[model samples]
Target: MDRKDISEKYKWDLSFLYKDNQQWERDFERVKSLTNQIKQYKNKLGNDSETLLEVLNLQFTILRNIGNLYCFAKMKKDEDNNNSMYQGLTDRAEMLMTEVDMALSFIVPEILNISKDTMEDYLNLDQFSIYRHYLEQVMKKKPHILSASEESLLARTGEIANGPQNIYTMLNNADIKFPKVIDEEGNEVEITHGRFIPLMESKDRRVRKDTFKGLYDVYSQFKHTIASTLSTEVKKNVFYSRARKYNSSLEAALFQNDIPVKVYENLIETISSNLDPMHKYVSLRKEILGYEELHMYDLYTPIVEGIDLKIDYEEAKDTVVEALKPLGEDYINVVKKAFDSRWIDVYENKGKRSGAYSWGTYDSPPYILLNYHKTLDNMFTIAHEMGHSMHSYLSNKNQPYIYSGYSIFVAEVASTVNETLLTDYLLKNTDDIQIKKYILNHYLEQFRATVYRQTMFAEFEKIIHEKVEQGEPLTADNLSNIYKDLNIKYYGKDIFIDEEISVEWARIPHFYYNFYVYQYATGFSAAIALSQGIINGDKESRDAYIEFLSSGSSDYPINVLKKAGVDMTKKTPIEECVRLFNNSVDEMKNMMLTK
Candidate 1:
């Protein structure tokens, strides 16, 4: 359906961003003018604290306007991607942003020239106090900041740095093709990247087996290329880490958000020491399925049939609001405003973006984009995206623009907390056995996929980067061997570690994302612990979590999370999440056994 056919109530009010495109164009010109004006302070940041503060405030103003213009245009295009006018607007906004960024490039280096002591002195000035953390961040980069010529050289290598991921993307998404296999109903199904997961979840063992082998077969044929591609990516990370004077690639990646290396190391070590829960879950799955040997492909198929919980959008909204009551009334009131005030763009339209996300700028209401379909998952998406929107809304409400946005580390926690709370509410309120079983199944898999699986991926990354850092090359054989060993260790003896699954590492795009997968495990564990505390703990716990939501980038993500009551640098939250998973497995086991 076209966007015009969607009801006004179903659509988001972009007027909060701008009443019309002409208003956006006006800001667009203002940013262009501000961009030039800020460039005049290029070498003057060291003049005085007030001068530095003036330039900084002007920089933020230009940034604020650019953000609003860019988001408004992009959201307009998202309303209908086929609309050329909005597309052109998006392009212009993007180019204007790039030009502004180029113009503001001198601020950091000039700040770095001032000694840390001097920077601290400037920060201590009453008028410059709000920028203490911001200046500290600039001063923190001093050791890593190279000479301008060296920095320019490194910046020029940007495309070269991207070569590995670019090649992998082309091969994985464009060139690779899979052979056809006979599916469940005796129809030929050709597997592509999109259909691979759904086919793996098919009830027919033959289809699942063939689908798995067919995709990996393509990867196997290009194993050398994939191995080389992954190797180059790993090597690139090592090169940049060394140039930046970081001790390791992992440390370098985490350092960008001020995350300590111990956080990553602690997650892997804690998870490694506690594989009993995972092994128990695997063993339970084998027993429940009555299969003597559980293959890798069989893991995704449902252990029990689920009720087709087709909920309408209106009903989903009420359910989400009801489920979120544990968070307090004020939170629920904002959610109600989201619904009544049209903060959400609901339903699919022709050329609308697929999937859902909560997005907007510091100045605008948090806008959500949804291609809503009536499903249990869609309802959960509402809860999840609302979690993000609320985080942004509260942060924007409480903090300055510079500190309003958050690190990706804490970003997933708010969303996952909402999901976990929704799950808790459903489990408690439901009287139907099937509904209970289905939710338990879903929750168990969420833990398995998010924490366990992603931890294994993170370990793979740590191993590979360490190898490259140690001057070792990753060959197809050793790379596959390393991945296969991880699978064996992670899955335990109850499951057959497929030989073909060795190349599964090549299929994951997240490997190219550079030590980024660990956040999934850490965030999931943190959310589980926080959600439990909020629902089962006292008022202090709820207040702390809300404060964490409002804190945003005002502090380091770890420090902010400490306020929320989970410390990623420790093992407690992960252990708690695993405990929940183990208990859930037992619950599902008892239900199946009694039935």
Candidate 2:
């Protein structure tokens, strides 16, 4: 069905953000003017506590306004990417944002210029209470904060630094096209990034192989181009790491959220050691599917067939709300509000962007976009994105703007917790053996995708960045060879490592995301621990999880998870995830044997 055919009740009301484009224009201009005002306090941040507080307040106001402006334009453009007017608005908003960033670049250096004793005094002032955490975060960067001139220069390079990612997005989403392949039903279907997964899950091996090859065929055509773009992105990360005096790009990336480097290292060390569960799952797949060998294309096909668990959008909404009831009455109420109110764009339209994301500013309602296909996976996606929306809603309500936005390190925890809860609810409530098997497979796949797969990506990221740091050139062959070796190690000798999988790195947009994929592995592990606690109905655990959601950037991400009773610094969480994966595999093996 076309998006326009969807009811107004199902579509998100972006009008809630701005009554019209005119209002958005007004906000854009106001933000532009406010950027000029930021210069007024350029050198006066440490004049006194009052001056510091005022500057902080002004900076927050300007940023908050820009957030709303950018959110509106970007959301509109995402609604229909073909709309040139909205696209232009998004471009202008992005440019204005870079300008605002450059204008406020001095604020950090100026704050760092103050003596620690005086900074503490200012933080203790009643007027500065709200910004205490924010100020302390600035102080943490004291060692890395450069002179104002250099800071401004770095900020100005922001747009240019985004060039690689922008190019990849255009090439992947807008420019590239996949060929048509015959599906299991003998119908010819065109492949897309959206349809690629579903196609891989096809019962017909012919379909899966065709879609996989067809998809990669296009990616292979431009491997060199994509390789160059990824290389540039890595080089950009290397540049900032050196400039900030960090030991490596990984350290610099993790430092932004104050995440310890050991967290990344621990995830790799632990997952690499725990590849037994992964190998076992692979063997189980090979045994159940009656395949002598498993290929990359065979990884996604269901082991137990004949169980159709497709869910429509309405059912998905109800399932999510019901599954999240363990969160408490107030949380359920907000989920209900999201369903009833126009807080989500519920269907795909022509030119609408692919995939799903929860996005909004402090000033606007938390919004979600989904090209929801009435499948079990899409149901989990609804639950996942709503987790993010609710986290934002609670944080924005509980804290001021400065502390409202959570770091990406902790962001995945909330979403994964929701998914975990949904899985548990499905398994407990269903009596049918087939249904149980399907849900169990889903849970196992989540671990494989989030923990094992992402860790592999993290290791790949680490290797590439280290190579670049050591002044090695990143050619297509060099990148592909490194990725192919990691694939062999992670998946083990049980499965065939197709040569086509070598260029798979060329297609993952996350390679350009700068040490970001590791968080998925860590966050998934943390969510497993948190979800287990929440499901136990322990008020203390529930309250702590809620508090973690509300905490946002008020504390370091590692410390925040620790407060929620999950010590990410320790190896316990990843070990717990590994144990869970093993347990699930055992259960699946038993179920299949009995059947």
Candidate 3:
């Protein structure tokens, strides 16, 4: 079916879970009532050890119910973006978050209020064993743990900090307008976000350059507004870090998973040291495309000549299942279940979120949404999202409620590892030279975007955040200059660095998410190492990687990856990943010569 048909008739049946709006309304009221009754535990928490345990368990059980309700409603809204019924459902879920914030506000500070000596005695008791694991995390913040009034003050300002990103989204997604660019046929065409990707992939150099200039022109028009929003977001990070007594914003964010500063530093250092390989890859693209001077607009065009292997959705599913057998029978079986069970929404629908993500709660199956275009890129995405689903399945089966969610640090490993396997499988099995060159170019492109581009983003984020922390203004000119300079460093003198690319920094949604983009680089690096181990048929390594998948947030993310055999703290894994990128470039260069 086409997208319109799917939008009208193929909306997911969320009724199997919640039944109706009336049912959701009933639960919402029930949760509100539960929240009001939370005061029963207040004074009694410090009276005796047994009472404290009962109060904590009550909080957990209540939260589990709140989570189920929220997940069901949010997932329904995600499947069909225009559905007002589920839109109400998501709004109600946010209300539940507020209810939770009010109800649970007393628990933490009160627990901290109990004297350290008294808590030590409580830990010695056999009754407190269940709560011991949780108490350890609390104690880490012991020095910064404030009075109940101060904690309440902190929570109150939370929504104020969200204002910047919300405004930016409104301006970018709904208000911004792009100028019309002349197409290959000598007709004017307006640029939209959806059109940007396909235009960048145009075989005609003029079309690519026109689209690039037109898109950034809109961003450049409102550069000041975008600058202010980005500045607010960076300031939000610095304020919270200082308020929480962390040395820096980066330390505060990374320390949640016990990740070291060196991991972030290592990614930048390793990618920087190996700049020649990336420069070589770009130069190779120039040769392959027969360009006299390589421009940024020419980079996305397919380097290999004519053989567009368009496998439809049916064929793509079968190929993914076959390509992933290196993950062993159990993993493949779960993937098969996802394929057969309608766990995925297969096509893009109007107003549905662009791009893809793997989402689920503890109570539901992992689900995916995709805009599949029957290209190798789309198939690799399928392999990627399914990797997340299987990883979720394994963790939910083995871990407790608190440990069910995995860290972003290791989140991309499973997905990228799947992509690596799929690429290798396609290359080994296909005899077509054009198809092989396409796949090789595809791998090189993936490395360029995910590893090289993200590291540049990470560095940009660091510089901008530090400037904000030092009370320096993050104006339009300031941001654009920093971004342009970084582009020069990464692309080197081999490619042109145009002034239009400066506004590129303003368009990225990732910058609003504090210190989040660095994980993309670290994750791809770790995945390369893990994929190599699995493909080599090393039993010890295979078991270790699987163990990492099963470990959610039960331990620090670094420790979890250590169990998986790739340590991010050291420079070895990142260097090894870049070396793999070099080797792929070498292979592609040799292939192009033979052609």
Name the top lDDT candidate. 2
Instruction: Please say which candidate is ahead in lDDT: 1 or 2.
Output: 2
Residue-level lDDT tens digits of model 2 in 377-437: 8899999999999999999999888889999999899999999999989999989998899
Candidate 3: TM-score?
0.92
Taking all chains together, the TM-score of candidate 1 against the true structure is 0.85
lDDT tens digits, residue span 1-595, model 1: 7789989999999999999988987888888888889878877888888889899899899988999998999888878766889878977887786677667767777888887788778877898878888887877878887764566466556646767876786577546778998889899877765456657767788899999999898999999999999999999899999998999999899988999898888889988888888898889888988898999998877676656566899999999999999889999999999999999999877666556789999999999988786766678889989999999999999999999998888888888999998998999998998888877877787888889999999999999999998888899999999999998898899999999999999898889988889998999998988887788957888998999999979998989998887888888888888888888888888998884
Task: Residues 266-378, candidate 3: write the lDDT tens digits.
Answer: 88888989999999999989887887888888888888888666778889999999988887898888888887777787776545545677887787777777766667777
lDDT of 3 at 512: 91
Hey, what RMSD does candidate 1 come out at? 4.0
Which runs of model 2 end up more than 4 angstroms from their true locations?
1-3
Candidates in order have lDDT scores of: 0.85, 0.90, 0.81
Total residue pair clashes for candidate 3: 0
TM-score: the better of candidates 1 and 2:
2
* Candidate order by decreasing lDDT: 2, 1, 3
Q: Which stretches of model 3 miss by more than 4 angstroms?
A: 1-4, 7-17, 72-88, 120-130, 174-195
How much lDDT does candidate 1 score? 0.85
TM-score of each: 0.85, 0.98, 0.92
